[model samples]
Target: MTSPLLVGFLASFALIAAIGAQNAFVLRQGIRREHVLVVVSVCAVSDLLLITAGIAGIGAVITAHPQMVTVAKIGGAGFLFIYGALAARRAMKPSTLAPAQNGSARLISVVLTCLTMTFLNPHVYLDTVVLLGTLANQHADSRWLFGIGAVTASVVWFFSLGFGARCLSGLFAAPMTWRILDGLIAVTMIGLGISLVVS
Candidate 1:
């Protein structure tokens, strides 16, 4: 018999594996080795909440509301296009972000940045909450197990990204590297947004 917990974990991991802005930020922070714990904690917690909500049947409501989904799709796509443009713009400019002066500022920045990266992207909710949640329901003998699996996946992924990026920090230190990363981010975001809108 397939355990709901295992299924949920695999499903959650599968959903999060997509390369998106949130993952990008997590990787960048990991590379910088700045507030990696804070970033990972926030992201993991946020995912936990969303996944739990989905397992609790929030996804059913979302699925039932076609109009709401349409509205969300539009809003999300628009936000992505704008965010992509901004990233592209930042890539063009010379980076002037000084290191955080203190631990408090660093913590705050991590929270805010993670929040922006996670919440600002509509795809997160769609994939993790709505889509994954809906799928989990199909095999839900015990919904809580699914939620646990989903949360576990979030924790593992965030930690890996936060710590793993450190291994590649040296490669990304150059200005050209930043530009390329930002450029890719911009293009990816815009492409995703347009695709969402058209489809």
Candidate 2:
């Protein structure tokens, strides 16, 4: 039999390892090596907090009242659409891929933006609260342990993405590389937004 911890870890990782808006933003910040630690910390901590809430039974409350999900869905879709457009514009622009010596934004701004991406996204709630929580509860005797496993996966993934991106700094030095990345980000965000609205 598969361990609850392993199941949780795999499930959480599978849900999160996609090319979503948050991941794209994290990847960009990582490549720039700008506030990488802060970004990773915020993402991981957010996951821990959400997962804890889910395991603590908030998941049941959310599942019982789906209006919350509907509200989140609408707001998240708008946000994703706007963000996607901006990314597309950036991709179309012939901007250099090099990070400015001072970086584009303040660390606080980056943190705030990251927070918006984390909290405002409906999928985050659906995946963490409803899906993961339900899965953990299925383990019954080991639900909390399952949650810990899921949280650990989050910690690992964020830190790896945030830090490991620097290794590709050389590749991202070319304008075309950034263009490609931003283009893909645009498509991903837009596609996800539409799906969220329609689904």
Task: Specify the highest-lDDT model's number.
Answer: 2
| Per-residue C-alpha lDDT of model 1 across residues 1-199, encoded as one tens digit per residue | 8888898899899888788778877876786688888889999999988887887788778777767667767876777787788768867875522123112335775677678767656677678888877877776577778788889998999999899988887777676776787788789889888887888
Candidate 1 residue-wise lDDT at 172: 74
Global lDDT of each candidate: 0.78, 0.88
Model 2 clash pairs are none
State the lDDT of candidate 2 residue by residue for 43-97, as single tens digits: 9999999988888888899888989989988988898899899889878886534
Instruction: Assess the local accuracy of residue 36 in candidate 2 as a C-alpha lDDT between 0 and 100.
Output: 95
Report the number of clashing residue pairs per model.
0, 0
Per-model TM against the reference? 0.83, 0.93
lDDT score for residue 116 of model 2: 81
Position 75, candidate 1: lDDT: 73
Span of ten consecutive residues with least summed lDDT in model 1 = 96-105
Tell me the lDDT of model 1 at 39. 89
